[model samples]
Target chain A: MKRERVTLRFSPDAYDKAITYHLVRDYGLVVNILRAEITPGQQGNLLLDLEGEPADITAALSYLSSEGIKVTPSERQIVIDKDSCVDCGACTAVCFSQALLIRAPEWDLAFDPDRCIACGLCLSACPVRAIHSKFSDPIEEAPPADEA
Target chain B: MATKTIAEINEKIRRGEAVVLTADQAAAMAKEQGVKAVAQQVDVVTTGTFGPMCSSGAFLNFGHSDPPIKMSRVHLNDVPAYAGIAAVDAYLGATELSDGRPEYGGAHVLEELLRGKAVRLRATAYGTDCYPRSQIESDIRLADINEAFLFNPRNAYQNYGAAVNSSSRTLRTYMGTLLPKFGNVNYSTSGCLSPLLNDPYLRTIGIGTKLFLGGAQGYVAWNGTQHNPSRPRNEHGIPVGGAATLSLIGDLKAMSPDFFRAAYFDGYGASLFLGVGIPIPVLDEDLARCVAVTDHDIQTTLFDYGVAERNRPSLGTYSYGELKSGQILLNGKKIRTAPLSSQKKALVIAKQLKGWIEQGDFLLSEAVAPLPQQATLHALNSKDEVK
Candidate 1:
């Protein structure tokens, strides 16, 4: 099984449609809605974590694009600029996922990309403005609906 | 067991026969063997604290150049350092903010030096008869300096208070970012592993005492600035609020970058994370019992940040043991509590200090004088009044 964090930009017309419901029924993907900002008849955003077989995840991404919804990989990550980062571990306090941690004996900041649920809590916890939101990662293949 | 002298402990250390234990180790030993038995055999208890100290800085001698400029002004990587001292000597204060940018400060400059990075050095002076160069803009690294020593005015706080927000709005405090509307609580201080907490009365941890400072050999230069030993205490002799601190001196060249980092609080400015370790000699059953005090016995009142006053009303007091359970009850709500201080680093320091003593390299010192217990701290006048 594979997991990916993706953000869906829903158009006013698509907002009224049961988008997540179809993904689960059609592709057999486990969709965990982390955050939802969209309302019916309004262009807005929806953040979700989708888990399923690699083939199913690829097909789910393809289906969303077919329904006129813009699909993009969130792939959110917490980046600590070493020069600015103080390793104060403020983020570790509110980090329920334990993705951001202080390595023992050295007390250096360590971020595990795999463990992050992209809650975006550490962005505010850092005192020095050291933590940055990064979308750059090895995003899994989510081909456009026409190709896959 | 009779009270042992510092001389006896040093002699044992010199002979590689000293019985030493880290604060965490000592706590466990006291529980298993009892404070009496442990005190009889142990020669020293190594304690440590890793926290953000704003009063930390270093004085550096950059060594004169071909045309020596009696540096009346100095800038390291665009961040200014106080240059009024001498030709090349300057003091970099931790809280000094960089030009315009509040986030980058003296701590960041020190970190750059620690990492052996070249800094943009700019200085100006009135041309003297002997030393005639007026201005200089050069790149300098820590390797080019003659001497660099960190003489921190304060470090190793005995104990600190826990912070939580009672108001509905979030508070960006000098303490780590407090979540909005009592969403979470944050606290600093190493709790049981803290240096002064283990010593309680400042019995053996004193001036000239050896310490593991920023992963290097250091010493207590003096009682730390704001050495308030008169804070009210509980039955266990632990200060309920802010208490004693220590001034430490160490070679900045030997300091580790890993332990020392430049920090910026959201509302408050830049400060350095100072790692300090002090070894306590188990002189008698009394001293041992002090070290044995667990987190359950060490309690402090959690203050609401909403008041924005020094006298923030206490939500209630909770023991370190209870706080460390990872959740604290606040206003009938079980709010999650997290420690800003790295207990993981504190434990590392304890183990390192123990290793130094067991190797017969570190020596414990007798206090020339205990930190003042009777000195009353002066409160600032809320309103100006005249007779």
Candidate 2:
């Protein structure tokens, strides 16, 4: 059994299909969607954690691919420009994940990326344009051409 | 023993023998060495603050051009400036926004001016004999200007209250974005390091007192706009929250951009994060003890911005140290806390002031008249029309 956090992008035609229902019934998987955006006959994106047998999850991905759906890993990180950041702590207020906080005594900002979900809400909250989102591109982040 | 005088301290500064410590250091030393001993040992206690000071502006005297005209209407870098004074003199407030962009304001213009950048100067007026011109638009740098002086009507608040949102909606405020429904908290004071907070009583800091103003030598010009000395205080004589403020004056050309940063509130207008440091000479043991105060000893009420009015409901009182904890327990819920003022910059200013006094480059002045101890701020009454 395995659990993986994945991002699924559905095309206009794929949006109408009951993929979530299929994952639960046919594949016997527990699909927990963290975030979702769907527009029937337009497009859709779902951030989900699929809990099922390793082989079954792989089969489900192939099924999604056959349905003209794209499967990708959800790997997002928040990057803060220390020099530009005035330490105003504007992002910390909207940070539901508690990744950004002020240090004690001196009152300096501290960022814990491990706790951050990379919700990207704080990006706009920052007045100085210091906070940013760094999405890991699997195509580029893969092993270098020479190393491979 | 005769009370120590500003002249006596100035003599020590002249001799390069003045002893100076930060407000926190003075208070800590007083706790250990006692106020009397510390007072006799230390010559000065420096106080500092780096916060978003909105009530600040600079009066610039633009050199007359080929076709001199009365600048009845003036704009500096697209930001409007008050030009009612003379043909070329204008007052650019810190929060006045540029016509193109609301976030860009006089603060940014002044900061650019400090960096020796040229600002757009535009004006319109009726032609006259001496100044016979209807319109004038030109680029002017700080050096091109005849004179520029910063006259902040209010800064260095004695002790300011903290703010929190208790209502169900997120409140966008100049206090930094307050989280909805008391989700978190925000404060705007440098606490123990603040000049007025240390003096609290306005004892040593007064008109004519020289200070480290925005990285240059300046003076306390007058009492700030809201000089509420009669406000409530704790047993230590320090006002509990929001009392005593100082109006300051300094040459804008002598100011540094490092001590001043332009701030744009998410919803509110532009404001300048001004850095000001004042050296308080310990004239007596009582004054020494007061300067020795710490963050734990000081307290300010938290206000809920949920109420849309001049008077907001007070949540509770918390010490600077307690508020610095990053989170506070209110109504059984842990509310996160944030600060708009920078203690890092405040510490740097305090250290810089201490070095200036040690180098004999800065001198402290005794308050000619202590700030009003009984003055109350009253709302203006409407005059009934006798028609």
DockQ for all models: 0.36, 0.39
In model 1, the Cα lDDT at residue B320 comes to 85
Candidate 2 per-residue lDDT, tens place, B1-387, comes to 326888898999999988899887887887888878777888888988888899999999988888788889999889999999988889999999999965799998998999999888889998899999999888889987899999999898888889888788777788877877787788888888888877777777777888888999988888989988888989878787788888989998998877877877778888888899988888887787788888888999998888886778888889988887778889888888877888778888999999999998887776666667777787654598353
**Candidate 2 residue runs with Cα over 4 Å from true position:** A1-77, A119-129, A133-148, B1-3, B380-387
Of the true contacts between chains A and B, what fraction does model 1 have?
0.41
For model 1, the local distance difference test gives 0.80
* Residue-level lDDT tens digits of model 1 in A54-119: 999998887888876677666445567877665557887667777876633455777876667666
Instruction: Show pairs that collide, candidate 1.
Output: B45-B280
RMSD of 1: 4.5
Q: Please give the range of 10 consecutive residues that has the lowest summed lDDT in model 2 chain B.
A: B378-387
Model 2: which residue pairs collide? B27-B292, B159-B242
Error of 2 at B367 (Å): 3.5
